[model samples]
Target: MMKCKINLNPKMLNLLFLISYVLFVFSLFNRDVSDIDVFYSFTIFAKYISLVLLLIGILAGTYTRKEILWFIVLLCIDFILFIKSGVLVFIIISLFAFHSTKIEDDKIIKLAYFTLLIFTVITFLLLSLGIFNDALTNRWVGDSERHTLGFYHSNVLPLIYSYLVGYGLSSGIYKKNHYMFLIIINFAIYYLCGSRNVLVATLLLIGSKWLIDSFLQKSEFKKMINNILCVFAKIIIPFLSMISLIVPLLMNHIGFFQKLDFILSYRFTAIYKIIQTEGIHIIAQMTNEMYFDNKIVIDNGYAFLAIRYGIVMLIFLSAIIYCIANKYSDNTFVLILIIIVACINFIDNDIIDYSCLPYLIIGEKYVLESFKRRGNNYE
Candidate 1:
């Protein structure tokens, strides 16, 4: 990654905004996540942009030995996920292109900014239009059983988008903008989307970023954060596990007696059933119906890999998280993004784990390094 002073053109800047818009729109009407409308059209165009990225990397990576290795390992994971998850690869690719604009020109940064903004605007509009006129989420996206504007309530969109706005305003092209305004806008979107997980994720992201920034400004912050994480990693979850298991589920059903035997609840039952389905394909069918129903969808990233892919892939994922867990720094916005996304994976099941976006993050910074490397050669 080369760094120098550069800017993106307005049109290109807007592309990032539109990409976010497309992602939100894609989530709205289609329960299956395979349907597309005008939103993802640019996603089709951005595939070329990814090729351009590789071309640039090949030309300049003569000295970016580390990056080249990371890129190869990344591409291999990308290929496997594509085969396993279907169209999600495109979303990752598009995000890569969008986030790749940093260390470029002002125009390029603006392009990424506008792309996110377009998403923000379109998502709000989708909900508002539905509310005001009593229309569906997207006109093109017709009826569905889930929580679309006129559909289903997956409860994760608001969290993801809200974190996105936080990522941008916190360290984005819009860093100068009011963080409160950015958060409020996304929170409104969360309400309209009706996703509690997103709300929790957004709060955690903001709190984590603020706390880390404040404490880490002092020399002791890193030690403090590590200590806290270590404690939570060990002591807290274990003590809470029994409480979590003992939790009385709230059910809106007939007869208090039937509901009170909460020990016979779906979750406890699901645990036993998960054990039972070890040798058969029926679990897949059961999981399909449970896709976005708060509890199942918002399990750990590890569980998501198992449920969606397989136990083998889940092991690969554990190894990847282990590698990333210690390697990355928490001082940057990317670090915050990683923390939030990783936490979301613990519960939200729909995401692509071990994604390709890290390459995009690298490229954004690397472009500057590329320029620096160029400058050094000249010197």
Candidate 2:
């Protein structure tokens, strides 16, 4: 018997991955396109093609035992959830893309930032010309209304703008480049979107990074502070995890929490209602019932995941993120990016989008690299 063999060029595969990722990002804007049927079909086709290319890469690439084990575990959880096959495929593709790609992380970061910058510029130009005004809506803040540029809803623009800001800051900080212009552009867009949460989150993320970096520069205090932080992180992370799991249940009875929820646009209240009325099994199936008679919207990403993919899947994902963070503890850029995204997720369901897959893929690649280093050291 002859063994079947297939070979793929790493460069070609990487190029294909980049192209597919760009297409996927473009597809996100398809929501605003009027001819939904044709555009939606094209978007779906682009996604499937990306998945196919990623599948091929996975077949041709080598994976560590740790990677394979986690992949199988996630696949099992996905099978149980069973509603969003596209999401499952996305997870698998991300894992494989991380394993198979030959591009350097810095290059990938630059590409992503460049792409976002282009999109922001183009969108701004279009908005200036009065294009997409039909899709624009007003976002209420206190007693006034603000414009949301070129988005069907006010929530989406802020999420998108925050991502750009996060990536811009990450790249700028890492490269030690002057990114003030990029930050300004992102802030202007966020302001126009009328998302106070996004503005606050972006500033907090940037400020947090700056503070950490400044503190670490103090040679005498650096080591001691690092040790203290590590210990605190160990305790606080698990505590926070438990808090997240129970926050929905608590939102119903807690008066102070109810007021806070109302301030945050009733996001927690809506999620609590969904879980209470629909049961946890609602996560195992995809439905629009979370809209609460097509009136309420659950904007929290964690809540969306818990309701759309089940508690088990959500826990699994949280664990995966925890593992990645633990593995890449020294990479401040990755850590900051994750933290920013987590903050944004509290206000929007951006995690469910295809754009987030690249970050996960990059983190997974780091995990695989760590595994290889461990094996090498043991040998």
Candidate 3:
């Protein structure tokens, strides 16, 4: 009797990974289905399936020693993370990022576009049908009501819309003429959600793309402008990370910093409170107050990562961002998108929580190049 061997086709693996990815993304954003047993099981199933497929791909494929070392390092970091927080999501996402190295950028873009669209439509439908309630509340006394539109908070709806516009416009999926429609959507989101910061970020996405396109005729000026933006891109993550950490320490002492914190809705104060409560660590540890009862969510992404996920995780994220910035230094649109996201990260915790396209691109550009350099053909 001859032994049998099963060889998984790489293309099929890629297709399966993409499907599982979208399913996982859908599971993440569909708030109503979270309590439903079927969808809850589906989320777990999708995540583990994606993880298994990625593990198989990594083990079966040929890779350089350096690449293997990098994988090991990531595994160790994630293992520490898992031990500390009892969360496997970070490791699963790391595997997804690695698995994405072999896939095409276009595939990720199209799938992300549709996935986000479906999520948005479903959320709206749920809200309209009264299945999901709007988080209508006033943060300050005598303030107007802000609508969440079925999301966890008022800003979430507009933030998701901003990401949709960012992915669509930066990928060239949406044309310049679509800016009017997109801007109208932003205004409507602001009207309903009352998220001014996200509204500005959304408008900046549209305006930056338009400005870049108009100046394309002047190659020298365009190149100069892109160079400036690229430099900003390289430093934005570290700069924001520093500010997120340092601002809280300074806010009480400096009136300017205090006013800035007030403008940011006292995010610095929240950061200070969390720091005083749980404290920062090299590796993120389980907090006594895992679910804060203070009613104010940590809005700063950098602080959230550093405080919640650990300073090491934040550093790892910054390194990944630097890699992306270096890889796309010449791609002005993507760089601008990075800067926009980084700016928003200062106030919003959406960078790693929700967005998938950036990581996919990072894997495509940085991870794929590593394999290619070692004469490994993913195809």
After superposition, candidate 2 runs with Cα above 4 Å error: 1-4, 32-38, 62-76, 83-103, 122-131, 134-136, 140-142, 173-179, 212-215, 224-245, 281-283, 287-296, 364-379
Candidate topping TM-score: 3
Question: What RMSD does each model have against the real structure?
Answer: 9.9, 4.4, 4.2
Which candidate, 2 or 3, has the higher TM-score? 3
Off by over 4 Å in 3: 1-6, 31-41, 56-66, 287-296, 360-379
Weakest lDDT window of 10 consecutive positions for candidate 1 = 279-288
Question: Ten consecutive residues with minimal summed lDDT in candidate 3?
Answer: 30-39
Give the lDDT of residue 43 in candidate 3. 67
Q: Write the per-residue lDDT of candidate 3 for residues 1-379, one digit (tens) a residue.
A: 1111535677776776666677667656654331234356666776667667667765555546656566666778778888777777677677766666666666676678778888788777877887767768676889889987777678777878888888798678889789899999899889887888889999999998887778763677767777888889878878999999998988888899899898988899989988887788888775435644444368888888787778887676666677777777778888898889889889888765546444534543464355446545544
| Top candidate by lDDT | 3
Alpha-carbon RMSD, candidate 1: 9.9
**Global lDDT scores for all candidate models:** 0.43, 0.59, 0.73
List the candidate numbers ranked by lDDT, top first: 3, 2, 1
Quote the lDDT for 71 in model 1.
Answer: 46
Candidate 1, residue 51: the lDDT equals: 49
